[model samples]
Target: MRIRATVAAVSAALALSAFAVPAAHAAGSTLDVTFSSMKVNSGKAITVGATSTVKVKATYTLTHPSGVSVANVLSGPVLYRGTSAKDADTQVVSDAPGTCTTVSSTTLHCSATITLPASDLYNADAGTWKQGGVAVDAKSGVQKWQNDLGTIPVRRAAKLTADATPEPVKKGGTITVTGKLTRANWETGKYAGYATQPVKLQFRKKGSSTFTTVKTIKSSSTGALKTTVTASADGDFRYSFAGTSTTSAVSSAADFVDVQ
Candidate 1:
């Protein structure tokens, strides 16, 4: 009787183990992840060097069985871009795991403060950048979910500076205005001049807020600006750059000049 009981116990345990393995692997229903929204610069272009951290938001919904819980959610810059060393997958932008707040049984509010290093931004091309998110299930290792947060243009940051010679000048005198145009150069690790680009010379009366564009001047080979203008009234002078496909527009601080 003892030998018979031991054999029966072993057989029952083996049967339970066989049934459990199949049930765990054959989880039913497809897992779905829907991101209702994402915000990056109000759905506009992203200007690198404008900020160190990229703040993004997304609302997500996971649809699976009632007992399944989300394992991980991630958001970062990615490419459905061309095959190139620089364009290869999202190696430049590191994985940013989102810390989500639960809203309901199947819904989650997620966000990630992603950091795009200056070096990466400096090397990456200025074009359409995609924000993607992914979700995983904890219980059933078989579930997979992915959604596109959105896409936005990423551009380089440019700089402009202006100065007027002989700040105190007699009325009706010819004053020379000098300035420089520069932007980030990843290869050189320096702020290099951006030449042959059109920039506007603008002026505003000391008491007035409105600025009138006096003339358009192009930068020289060294990105230097040297233009002479007749000083009439006490006013402020500056330069404005209309950015290119790879760079963002920028304007210099107003340089105040005193006219006697």
Candidate 2:
């Protein structure tokens, strides 16, 4: 899988530049700004799928000294996978600077978006990520970075499939259900099996809107699912995965079965 050129360039700049800003800045000038109330994706997990781009919204409060001119500053949110941006295993940044609304002479409420394309990420990138903010003085090139404002989960999107064999079966006969569980593999830009995860078998009567859990089973090493249920009535069957820290929950399309 190919990592986005933009991300690679930005990541390299983050490691080499001062305060994690893309641009080079003066050595000793202090931006003298503080970031607070940083909320990434509204404090929710970021779920990304294969071949799609995920845009995450972030909001924060920026405070600056009255002597500082906020008009010439460019600031935005940052997501990193290590202790700090300079040493991060991977990092993601907004394409544009954050837009801010002045709340007071010394405070501004800012919002920005960070885009994540599956091709730019690796499977190992899924997990807890630290949140941070960066401010750069457009005039003097002074920069400041605030790390560990909070943390958020970055998870891979999961998929489940369910199929019931024997469209029409005797009421007392056996019905076999099978499925596969898979999640986005950013390393390969494809969906791969998610093994050893618990998934639920659910059923709903033909006319019902709610599905009740029938049984629970663990996916095989290959993420394949197979089970047998005694046929009793006409209904729909599906597999449901509750999800985990690194994966998003998903349910398969309902497969209708007819009982004689």
Instruction: Please write out the lDDT profile of model 2 over residues 27-65, one tens digit for every residue.
Output: 656688999999999999999997778988899999988
- Superposed by TM-score, candidate 1 places the C-alpha of residue 260 at a distance from the truth, in angstroms, of 1.5
Q: For candidate 2, which ten residues in a row score worst on lDDT? A: 13-22
How high a TM-score does candidate 2 get? 0.89
* Highest-TM-score candidate: 2
Estimate, for each residue in 122-203, the C-alpha lDDT of model 1 and write its tens digit: 4456667665433333345333323355666766678899998688999999888999998776444467788999999999
The reply for model 1, stretches above 4 Å from the true place, is 1-31, 41-44, 50-68, 71-95, 122-124, 138-148
Model 1: per-residue Cα lDDT at residue 47: 65
TM-score of 1: 0.72
Q: Which pairs of residues collide in model 1?
A: none
Error of 2 at 52 (Å): 1.9
Question: lDDT of each prediction vs. the true structure?
Answer: 0.59, 0.83
Worst 10 residues of 1 by lDDT: 1-10
